[model samples]
Target: MRVRVATTILGITAALLAVPACSTDTAPPARTEKPAEAARQAAPLSSATLETRLLDESDLGEGYLRKPERPSQHNDVTVIGCPSLSELGGDAATGGTLSFPRNAKADFTYGGSSSEVSEELYSDNAAKLSHGIDRIFDATTSCPTYQVLAGGTPIDMASQELPAPRGLGDEQWSQLLTFSTGDRSTVVKQTAIRDGSLLLIVSGSPALVDRHLDKALAKATTTS
Candidate 1:
């Protein structure tokens, strides 16, 4: 179900091209304490190196295929606002349509007819990345149910906050969203983790996403 949810969401990537990247608003300040000295010492992943380490179809298990037509990189941060359950990384970055400063980003998707996985990398400081997570937690908590129009159709959606997974990053958040229209339904499991200056988001089947996240963080840790 989460894979199907991610697939539906990835289908709307083209729609994001129309959203203007003009928002100058930054995320609201977080109430948490500053990062520890050790956290600050961790290295950031460069765009080039991140691309090399990103998960491809091979890493997504057998029979999972990638789209050759998809762009290798996406620079416009504002396009994260599109309404799709699998767009968890985008939703986290923009704080549910609230834009924030992001210096660089890269995303890739692998899918089959019934399942999909989406991974997104965002480059920013620990504070900014943490703030973005806070915003998403706040939004999901305050308003569990909401609607966003995608391609002029109202999509009914609901979110449920889950306990944060440990040992993934400096800070992490997880949630589940169910999207419905008439009888069709899709459920997505999303996880956002802040590893030093990089923010990694993976959405789809929880098990697959979790597995890939561990691999990603491990590669990120070794990035020079």
Candidate 2:
């Protein structure tokens, strides 16, 4: 599975954590309850509103420092040797991650530690929000193990589906990704949860993501 396939576009920074996580073996289908999600839909919030809701240095408490937000940019990542993705066509870019018109994000570092965590919020119609995360999860199953070419550098990537944090939202998707190039390996955990028209994506070191997942979600769903 792609452990921290972090280039994930959600964070563009997911794979906009910006990130995506995975393992080596095939992953199961993402779990979603479409009918239930639609029934609970909340009015989609604007980007400005989501910005106010973004988790800040204080939200993460002590030891976690907010990193400067990077401007969103186009990613030219290409996936190689994934037959299913190839069959789907137009699915090549971003290794299956996506972007949205109304979104806000933040990145953070823990003390001086090199490890970081990220939060991304997306607001759109329910269908688009659901589809956005679904595409990334789809890649985990279709390209369990594949090669990613980032700036002409060959990166070996693998992904394994992780169980979503149960009952976090109307629907959820989770995975772990491992990115390797030579002796270096990075593991990232990505979990995307949606409530109404809002989608919250969190990615980074597995433990940190787990620690902050609930907090991030709570903030995103709170009514203004």
Candidate 3:
């Protein structure tokens, strides 16, 4: 049961897209006049290829693209959901999904999410994807329990259960997180997979967002 939904961003600030390299000061030794060695060194290992493409309104999958009435500078965001695949992009056979965005040279902004739950408990297995906007959530947040998997391998699960005196209702679990990271404030909703797990991803610049990690926990009373 995989379903997709869309969200809006008031004003978006594209995060830093460049991945941080290791902080190493060691330099390579000077090359000798060896013809064979010089030729091998000159040969490129990897080609200068484009990495990402921006998703525009016209470029999104049918019925998956949406634009707010009041348009803004960072208004281009296309989201998709597939339970069997990462929301980002990679191949299914080799765990990868591809997105042919608008242009090759453009710095694209995107997020990834996936979740699984027991059919007996949850109505639909749903996932959410949002772009062009950061999550908005309060400083004090409550995350729901979710299953975790690494490369299709079952890892663990995560939960948010309080003492009997203070417990949240099921409806509250669907509420979004109100938080501000750097120049953006974001709110992300939690989707529980009755006896399954979910993955919410975030990527961009520090000025926009930071770590994109999955929160997992194991429950004491497992669902059938």
Candidate 4:
């Protein structure tokens, strides 16, 4: 069975928002660009614009096909069967999300292969957006190893930090996850890029993510 990993981060913002307001930890430094300037630099993406920028079936090689687009109203983490975002942190809403899937179905013992390109745009102020990203980064540091139950089967997932790819966005961080069950294993790589006010997430196999990075960046630049 193919597992759906897109819904993982919906509740993360809410959970993260639950954190006590009096915490003494300092927020990450503000970006050189002001919020208003960043917003002006990249206008928010419309549904129509997003559809045009999504990678088409022809973009992937033979055996790879484009799945229907199912955009969400929240961000996603890599956990397959996570029950709640509080497991990660925060209790308030965060951002809007859009996902494009390119899948390869195989009859092998393990489930078929799949990949996704997701974009999250934070409508909140720059401080909130930066704070949200910072919280995500900090959360990843503590939960390196975790498990989620998919269809009653426990899926083992592991997370590791990856250096950002060059020249794509203002700031970037990646999470490499390995999901395994029995003899079947899948590698889901996710890279998050903060370009102006948009958080572009590329997820799938490492090769797939790499292949789409430049295209994603180019399209993101045209978000006016």
Candidate 5:
């Protein structure tokens, strides 16, 4: 079974912390229920936002897709304005583990997992993840996926055969795609989940979707 993958955009750095205590070869499908209240309680700083910047390898840290600018405070919710996946080399999968600078105090770190899958399977799985998101989110791109949540309401999701790159190979790397929801007035995000790791790229600027190089990499530690 596939799980619908839900990621946090820059606006608020929040993800449901459902501990994967078991190392099951098969991950159960994602639950449709909203994220826990604990995540919602994090509360976002309305004024806090991410500045648009390049998503080049130079921009990446240890292995993370960093926000253009750091949030005002540690764990502060920062919105990634707009992004261009191509700038980050579009799914080539860089080698090495990625980590945020200690000074940045960013709450999450993603990328560089010991697990992997072939490009053929990765591409096929991306399609399933895409279809699952379409069932949950209002708008999204065909390849790389992105979604926006309204009023801090977290959307539950799942995916199957999510791929994790093992250092820039033929594996069709998944990326975050920007999109909007609701009245289309507020909230936008980008998402990329394969294998077990997921990346949520976000931005909020009312109908200003672009390919301009903006990205956020939120890493969740997964077991199994």
Candidate 6:
């Protein structure tokens, strides 16, 4: 049984977003290339371009069906327990100094059942993108357990760190989140991969995320 979150942030953040980079830097190469690579990465992508790169029903194959896009809108959510998450009260989907200039999103459900997978793309400068990813992961981890007030009703939420998938991106973060209302609880996994100026987040059923993460990254980076 799925415990759907009542709040916008919980719904979007849960179905919508997830985040880090480890400090295992190897020594820099003896030879360095021109700064062209830096400029290229800093370049922003347009929303249309982003949409083309997102996974479609075709890319996902046989039984997967794309879910309709949610309209562009925001209903603020209030966070009561975690100071780090307090910032989320204003805009949970996307906002603030490190704002992504362009974004594209797509959602899918597998086999006609409740199993789902969603992907989001954010484009900007590498530095800003990296910071944005960090912000999400940091806030979630700031409090292992927290409370949110949505629609005048208080909901209990929990965030637990999971080993992120490696060797797929420059840096990544993974977490298992639980949203509870009374005895019913909804569990979801979010894995975020940050490569250069692009940040890709794949979240939903744990199995679905793992099954298509590599595919999502490959398609997102390739030109149409």
Highest lDDT against the true fold, candidate: 2
Clash count per candidate = 0, 42, 27, 13, 21, 0
Name the weakest run of 10 consecutive residues (lDDT summed) in model 2.
10-19
Q: Mind giving the per-residue lDDT tens digits that candidate 4 earns over 1-224?
A: 12234334422222212212211122332223234344434444454554555545555445555444344343443344333323433342122122222211111011223334333333333344555665665454345666655445665765566666645566666666666566666655566666665556666556656776777667655645
Off by over 4 Å in 4: 1-6, 9-43, 58-63, 70-127
Candidate models: Cα lDDT each: 0.52, 0.70, 0.21, 0.46, 0.24, 0.66
Report the candidate with higher lDDT, 3 versus 6: 6
TM-score of each: 0.65, 0.82, 0.17, 0.59, 0.20, 0.77
Model 2 C-alpha lDDT per residue in residues 91-134, reported as the tens digit of each score: 33354434677889887888655678888899988777887677
- Once fitted onto the true fold, the runs of candidate 3 whose alpha carbons sit more than 4 angstroms away are 1-172, 195-224
Cα displacement (Å) at residue 116, model 4? 6.5
Tens-digit per-residue lDDT, 32-93, candidate 3: 12222222211111111211112332342233222222332322222212232123222221
Name the candidate, 5 or 6, with the larger lDDT value: 6
Sort by lDDT, best first: 2, 6, 1, 4, 5, 3
lDDT of 1: 0.52
Q: What would the per-residue lDDT of candidate 6 be over residues 60-110, giving only the tens digit for each residue?
A: 899998988776554445566677665544443234433465989888878
> What are the C-alpha RMSDs, in order, of all predicted structures?
10.1, 4.8, 23.3, 10.9, 18.6, 7.9
Candidate 3 vs 6: which has more TM-score: 6
Considering summed lDDT, which 10 consecutive residues are worst modelled in model 1? 1-10
Give the Å error, residue 218, model 3. 24
What TM-score, to 2 decimals, does candidate 1 have? 0.65
63-123 per-residue lDDT for model 5 (tens digits): 5343334443333121222122122221111100111111112322235321111100111
Candidate 5 — which residues are off by over 4 angstroms?
1-10, 13-72, 75-185, 191-202, 211-224
Question: Which residue window of length 10 is worst by lDDT in model 4?
Answer: 102-111
